[model samples]
Every structure is written in structure tokens, then in C-alpha cells.
Target: MTIRVVAKNYVKPEKVQDFLGLCKSLVEVSLKDEGCIDYGLYQELENSGVLTFLEEWKDEKSLDQHLNSSHFKEIFPLLSEYLEKETEVNVYRKTL
Candidate 1:
């Protein structure tokens, strides 16, 4: 089954641009990975500090592969430096 992943990040006000730059690199590479159905980043209209990543993967295994990817390993830890709080990530399986 396909899986969808959503990650919400609350960035520090001063770090929003830096956070976006990093995410742009992450998205560019993640989209090229096998089994990555889709990947995108968005910012809340009302809350500029809130950025979200919406992703679709072929399956749990594909998602796992992405999590272990070298780019992810290198970029993810750096994200904490820009965040005001921990990111919130959730995975969902299609129900129908």
C-alpha cells in the first residue's frame, strides 16, 4: 500500500530562510529516489514559521529507504538547529 508522510516544522524566526534552503536541497534529492511518488514543501499562509513537508511513498519499505538515505542522514540533524521545537511527523496508509 502507498504511504503518505507529513512533517511539520516550527522554525525559529531568524532561521526560516536557512531552513528553507536546506529543505530545498533535501526535496530536490528525495524526489529522485526510487519509490518516491511525490515530495513537496509548503508554508502555512497564516503562520510563516510553520513549514510542512508532504510526501508520498510507494510503501513502508520505500519510506524506510528514504529515512536511511545519505542525504537524509546528513540533512536531518542539521534541521534541529533551525527549529524552535521538535518537528512533528506522521505517516498514514491509504484506507481505500
Candidate 2:
């Protein structure tokens, strides 16, 4: 089944641009990975500090591989420091 993942980030005001830049790089690398069906970043219209990622992968194994990927590991620390609040990630399997 296709897996969908959503990650919501509440970035510090001072680190917004830096966070976005990092996200851009992350997205670039993610798109190049095997079984990465889709990946994108979005900012809330009313709240610029809130960033969200919408991603789709071929299956659980693909998603697992993505989580273990070098690109993911390399940028995670940088992304973690910018969060004003804890990040939220949710995964779902598409039905129908």
C-alpha cells in the first residue's frame, strides 16, 4: 500500500528562512531517492512559522529506507534545533 506521511514543524521566528532552505535541500534529496513517490513543503498562510511536509512512499519498506537514508540523518540535527515546539509526524496507509 502507498504510505502517506505528514510532518508539521513549528519553527523559531529567527530560523524560518534557514529552516526553509534546509527543507528545500531535504526535498531535493528525498525526490531522488528510490520509491519516493512525492514530497513537498508548505507554509501556513496565516502562520509563516508553521511548516508542513506532505510525502508519499511506495510502501512501509520504502518509508523505512527513507528514514534511514544518509540525507535524512545529515540534516535532522539542523532541523531539530530550529523548532520552537516539538515536531509532529503522522503516517497513514491509503485505502481505496
- What is candidate 1's lDDT per residue for 3-58, written digit by digit as tens? 99999999998999999999989999999988999999999999999999999999
Question: What RMSD does each model have against the real structure?
Answer: 0.8, 1.0
lDDT at position 95, candidate 2: 71
Question: What is the Cα-based lDDT of residue 17 in candidate 1?
Answer: 96
Over the stretch 3-94, how does candidate 2's per-residue lDDT look in tens digits? 99999999999999999988888999999889999999989999999999999999989889989999998987779899998889999987
What are the clashing pairs of model 2? none
Tell me how candidate 1 scores on lDDT.
Answer: 0.95
| Candidate 2: clashing residue pairs, number | 0
Off by over 4 Å in 1: none
Go through the candidates in order and give each one's C-alpha lDDT: 0.95, 0.92
